[model samples]
Target: MSGTERGGGSTVDAVRAWRGLAETSVLLDGFHALKHALRFGARVPVALTSDKAAVLALAEDLAPDVTRPLETLLAETDEATLRALVPRLHPTSVAALAVRPSRAAQLETLARLPRTAPVVVLDEPRNLGNAGAVIRLAAGFGATGVVTTGTLDPWHPTVVRGGAGLHFATAVERVDADRLPPGPLFALDAEGEDIRALKLPDDAVLAFGSERSGLSEGLRARAEHLVSLPMRPQVSSYNLATSVGMTLFHWASTSGRPPGTGA
Candidate 1:
């Protein structure tokens, strides 16, 4: 099969399309990533695999909902050619390029009002993997979005890979602390109102500090309430992503609506 011919196009056409969009597109590195992205309505222009049959089989077993689209989308190429395109080819031997959502669109999403779920804010997070995990958590909890304050691009490839293509499931963007969405700010800290005693509101803006530091002075200043997760005396702090997961869970428990159900 010289590139799983489809729509009168061959591997050459797919490779050319991949190259054309490589710089401007988000790379869906593996079968699962592609699967999740497609489920969330990502615009995947080109999907390549060394074994189209295997990819389709995996999809049939794991995500039958997307199987037809995968069948129509996937283009098979030689393993060597596929590896050349993606240096670190995934074990599943599938890769694709998806259009990255525009920053303007994401900003609009983050700014939308009447939010039925809390928006998770990562204050100056330093770890790419942690940022990705937080995005995944936000998607799982049906949070309004995940906003990062700092230099790290939340949409970086490493972060996206960590997110397993769920970036499409939730709104994600980087913004200055002052520009965060409209909500009652709640910053997590060691010394604050005990989280157990306070019911986190659905539209709350839950902010967690970086791994090395608790909270930035700017973020702390903006917070209307300082919330603390329960901890024993000796423990210093929780992981950034872990802290987010707990806080969002707390909000979901009290919101009287199921997570991801949408208000």
Candidate 2:
């Protein structure tokens, strides 16, 4: 089999594999996304690129660690075919399909005790982009996981795109507020205690409300403590992702662990 072959099969076989797995797999769009996913131990079964040589060059320059794997996994295909496989072909002209982590495994990770990092919770977030950004932030801060309550699928393709393949770096799941892992729930609210005066615990469940409305009644009821981010009096609220970033920064700053060092 040639390097251009689909993990030992032909291009046709690669297309077939993509079609077979598209519905079940996570779409890793663009070179950076694929690189991040591969670095984080995501199982990429199929990867396609319009220009395998160029992509290999990119890996050589930016990600020497995954260069060999890219050489083996990337199947060269025509631009039109690549476009057909993905709704929008990334500017880098590379895309891949990665196996979504099992829900049971993520839940197990979330439920484990003595967590060294906080778990971020989005209370009924309405924006897919915000959810994705939060996941990215959670992954960056080495948070235990990112949990979302309400309708938005934490693993939605749009969210995945926004996350830039960092979802595999941390646990992500859509669970109700009651199902959140073992931790003291510190819900973010304008009326709560000033965050600067408090020391966020490693096992804290940092919850933020939706963009339009504040925390849902159910989540607010479950919260043991309410915390507030510092803001000017006239400002309404921080963006969902921004709030998560600030909270995680505060946690990491005081937790004695560098960001990105998982517990």
Predicted candidate 2 versus true structure: per-residue lDDT over 59-114, tens digit per residue: 99989998988888988899888888886888999999998999999999999998
- Per-residue lDDT over 1-263 for candidate 1, one digit per residue giving the tens place of the 0 to 100 score: 11122344588998998889899889888998999888888888889999999999999999998888888788899999989889988899999888888899998887888888888999999999999999989999999899999899998998998899999999999999889988999999988899999998888889999988768998998899999999888988888888899998888898888989988
Off by over 4 Å in 1: 1-8
**Per-prediction TM-score to the true structure, in the order listed:** 0.95, 0.96
Question: Model 2: how far is 31 from its true place, Å?
Answer: 1.0
Q: Which residue pairs overlap in candidate 2's backbone?
A: none
Worst 10 residues of 1 by lDDT: 1-10
Clashes of each: 0, 0
Whole-model alpha-carbon lDDT for candidate 1: 0.88
